[model samples]
Target: MLLACSGVLAAPTSVSAVSADGGSRITQVKVYPGSATVERTARVPAGARSLTIRCLSPQLDVQSLQVQADAHVRIGESSVKVQDRDLDKECATPLDDQVRDAEDRVASAKAETDSLELATSYLRTVATVPPSEPHSGPGTPGSASINGTTDTLRRSSQDLLLKLHQSKRRQEAAELALKELTEERNRIAGPKARTSTVTITLASDREGELRLSYQLRGPGWSPSYRAALDSTSGVVKFERLALVAQNTGEDWRNVQLALSTGQPTRSTAGRLPGPWTINVAPAEQFTTEIRAMPAPAPVAASKVTLMSMGDRGAETTPAMPNFDVQVSDDAYATEFTVPQRITVPSGGQRITLSLGSLDARAQLVSRTSPGVEPAAYLIAQLSALPGVWPAAPVALYRDGAYVGQGRLDNNSDELSRTGLSFGRDERVVVTAEPQQQNSGSAGFTGANVERKVQHAYRVESRHQRPIALQVLDAAPVSQNEQIDVVSQYDPLPADKAWNRRPGLILWSETLAPGSSLRFTAAHTLRYPKDARLQESK
Candidate 1:
């Protein structure tokens, strides 16, 4: 008697599943801008890492799913918004489902091929065996009949072999099915591992408030959030959480927590803030936290003055150019003039050109009448006063060259003997000296200026990999003049100067113009990423 075939008799199928069944059934869900949801049950095996449920109805479109450990939830029905009919054409089908289906088909085809091979081999061996004979040869009665039976058995065996060969040909057709399935799977699964993304964009506000927001998406699902508010004034401050969560689950539960509103730390809101921190936590696990409100920057106010003009002693009818000098926080000053054509033509005059207050801190610049464009001049009184020193060293750098310190000519004996001056069209920069005062100053520093002036050469390297470069000196060194070396790009404070010392090593007492000073700075050039997983350009 033949046994009836059951569904189980067809083939052995293994189902991989996700964990935890949901108490909620996501039915009739709609996303405002071209999004959809679908629900369906999946038969998943126990202790599986993940399980994807399929949508039964073609009318339903699924954008994403939320699966917890140990649960296989399916799409019941989906409500999708078709904003543009064009989008519907492109986003009409669920690509992920296609990929999964393709993978399954490929596996099934491989299994079929193996089974067919076995059957073909067994049939070939059977055909080669001679059929058993139940005949008494020679004088035995009905021996002729026994020979005929043998012949019939042999023909049947040959037919069976032919059928086995046909089955093998059928397996070849199955390969095409496998290939199609694989292509579909690839189309669905975009080539990258999913990760939670948090973007801290600085929003524009006249009040100088810091606004932050977050958005997240994953397999079978999508979610978004936004938070905005002003931070307090100081080196650092904290603010309240302000985030809104949206659920995009069909049959599974969707939960979200505002971990930290503005976490400035490497760890979660719970961790301490550091100089370097890159990652943020999931939005669902923590409350919105805003910390360390940065302080507002100070405005720079500077002033310049002409302290003295030598005694204008001359004939009663001496002549001078129209002198206009005005002094104020504004660029205002006063002017005076002596009648033209009168000259004493005697000893050099000592002019006391007082332009600034001794106690006030401000920048000073000047211009003289007759426009002779003095070859060199110095501020003697200003140099003597220590309070007037700029935050950074100020030098008369003209035409890519430094002025000699020996040329400083200061006549004022009040403050100090030191003085500063400039030639025609030359800039006398009273710059704040470059120094890592607090190790956290954001403004221009000495090291920063040095780095900018230093030459940079590109070195090719592998992406995301560390690279190192050796420093070498190629030029003679100097003493009166100074040279500093530095590297930019995730550089540490210690790396500011290599070997716990400055990068510079003096080649001589002075490095004149055209002298070459060389040092190597190593950096890795990142390679382009794999196109499949990257955001579409």
Candidate 2:
């Protein structure tokens, strides 16, 4: 018995669809400084032999496209082709519809205007034409009839002319609308499409999922931070955030996003050492000529010049921590994985994502340089974290109130601490005064000239609580061997040569409420009468 199935079986054919469909989604994104790697997963139907991923962003790096599938599936050759027609089709639909609608309105308006023009012409001709027969006496019926016809024609012509003007105005308005619509369509659709197609062939015994990933340009992210310091608790809440933006021509909807510190655009290979050569210059002998200098009387010393240093109250407690990303550290880079799926639309708008927060130990102190500014600023000494923190703008807060902004310097590998100034502390008052400057000859045979200057500073703390204050001052540093410089401080400074800067000193003290402190710095310079110091000023 020969039995056949009623319905004929059809051969399997390749199916193509834009990756924007529900079957495909951005699974992971690794963003660098100027570009990003996007991974997408697409579901393939069973018994499918081939599939085409359509409408990929033209900005995608074709060489970086990669594909993977289940073990049972045999992946075949993949290709990328620019689909110019597809782009035109994608952008033409709505714009074409609008243009067509506007054109139709314009046509209708022109037709109405033409009809009014014809009616006006007919009435004008009738009013201007002579009577068909010679008029009899004025009181005759024929003359009266002709006169009535002429009056009717004149009134109708005026009415038609008014309508003609109205119709012309309507037609002009419709034409203007059509022109605007055409310009808009041209702006949106452009001359050509910027889209491509990525086709991959696969042979699978059973159904399996496929994933395609590619690196694309025009997407990037940068790190930003918010540092809130609670002076009472001596803790600084440091929050890491990311400002991510993309203009990849396609929206990333409900996708897992990741930010990486590694710059893929940089060279991956280790730099090879180049040849080094050294050359020496020939030596030349020089002769010096000396002339007798006139002996002059000692001049009166000038007044000591005091060097001037080169230069929000809100009570909103930040809501409890709501960090929504996880951080992973690899050998070469740090990755921040967003915990929830997010939608980042195309265009260059930035989406801020909270990476994490940490409470770092911080010491609060008031700092002042009376020679530069009399006001004292609230400063914080923050301990460094394990990972490298890229230099970024830090928003500062003190005691749950907005204070100011500071910068975190993470440019050095050996940086273990950061000092940030919140804002000026008006409660502490400081004043500096220069006392005396004396210059005269000293040493054996009066060969050396001595210059001495004195300065004094007083600081008063009016805060209700005890506060730590640091005062900074600088003394002249002699760069010449003939010039000898020495300094005397009334109260020993906490740090001499602060931050490895010569002649910089810091005086630290703890002041009780309504307490005052005084300090004095005396600088003495001795040099030969004929020699001048390079950096004496």
Task: Please report the candidate that would top TM-score against the real structure.
Answer: 2
Worst 10 residues of 1 by lDDT: 1-10
Q: Candidate 2 deviates by what RMSD?
A: 14.0
Residue range 87-118, candidate 1, lDDT tens digits? 22222234445555655655666676677666
Worst 10 residues of 2 by lDDT: 1-10
Best by the lDDT measure: 2
Candidate 2 Cα misplacement greater than 4 A, ranges: 1-23, 83-193, 205-207, 279-323, 386-388, 410-418
* Clashing pairs counted in every model: 74, 0
Which regions of candidate 1 fall more than 4 Å away from where they truly are?
Answer: 1-132, 135-214, 217-500, 503-537
For model 2, residues 1-537, the per-residue Cα lDDT tens digits are: 000001111124555322222245566767777788988777666566666666566787989999999888778888787656444443234556777898999999999999887776655554554556454454333323555654686686778888889989989999999898776544432335366667777776566778888998757777778988887788888888678877665656656667788777665665454555544544563544444445544433111101011111125643443346777898988887776566665545566777778788877889999978788998887566656577777788888888877777656522232278888999999998767899999997999999998889999999999998899988888777888889999899988888777788889899899999998999999999988556633
TM-score of every model versus the real structure:
0.20, 0.72
In order, the Cα lDDT scores of the candidates are 0.27, 0.70
